[model samples]
Target: MRQVESEEFERLLTDFEREAVHLETRDAYGTAVELPHMAKWAAGEPDDLSWLQGWCETLREHGRAGRSVRRARIVSEPLSDYQRWSHSIAHPMVDAGEDIRWVPRRLVSGVGIPGNDFYLFDDRTAVFLHYAGSGLSVGMTATEDPRAIGLCRTAFEAVWGLATPHRDYRPV
Candidate 1:
């Protein structure tokens, strides 16, 4: 296992081959890029979501390459403010080819999940996300350990099986 800086982590997002599966176990986050967007959402301001175009374009390129990108979010019922805003902005990404799903936390009581959120690339590398209490990211750690890979695979598949496709889910 090795500690990965944010820049390397960003590279991993586009460098993977076959697929990228992400599991989000948090209901809230305070990422610098996202905070302002969420604040605008909270204030009922309009957001054209131009900032997301780059990622969406990336997704499109991945799609063209036959690479799959999927994300599963484990959220609480009634949803947090962040998730509410997230749902609103997901359409463009979904439209661009990422398969985004949501699983209500109550449904996963019996499943064993990793303590941190992560992105598993091509089922080989696992980059775990670490965060402060305020939900800002502290750092990221990456590993190619089989045990970590297996656990993440198991947990993500379990949640994915129970999750609702974004278009079909209505928060709470």
Candidate 2:
């Protein structure tokens, strides 16, 4: 498991030839970049998501190149503040050609999902993002191990099949 820098992780998205799939297992992520938007959403104010334009554009570019970007988020039943905020802001990504889905944690009881969040690229490279106790991203581990990639691909597909699409999911 070689630790990868954040830039390296971002590079994978642009470098992948076929698809990029992500599995988010955390209910909340304490990233400073998102705090302001999350606060605005929590306060019932209109969120200014201009900061995400770059990312949205990246997804759009991938779509133009005939690549796919998809994500499956496993969230608790009673949504956390972060989860609610995330749901509220998911439209931009969807509009940019990324497919996002939400899966209730309770429904994943018997699923053999990995504990950590990860991004699998082209079914070959798996980059597992590590988080601290407070949900801050610590680092990422990149692996090309077939066994690890197989598990991630299988688990993500299972969740994707069971999860609801962003347009249809109503957060609790």
* Candidate with maximal lDDT: 1
Task: Pull out the clashing pairs in model 2.
Answer: none
User: Where does candidate 2 stray beyond 4 Å?
Assistant: none
lDDT by residue (20-90, candidate 2, tens digit) is 99999999998889988888887889966899999999999999999999999999989998998899899
What lDDT does candidate 2 reach at residue 113?
A: 88
Model 2's alpha-carbon lDDT is 0.93
* C-alpha TM-scores of all predictions: 0.98, 0.97
**lDDT of model 2 at position 78:** 97
The residue-by-residue lDDT of candidate 1 on 7-109, one tens digit each, is 8988999989999999999989999999999999999999999999999999999999999999999999899999999999999999999999999999999
Model 2 misses residue 101 by how many Å? 0.3
Worst 10 residues of 1 by lDDT: 1-10
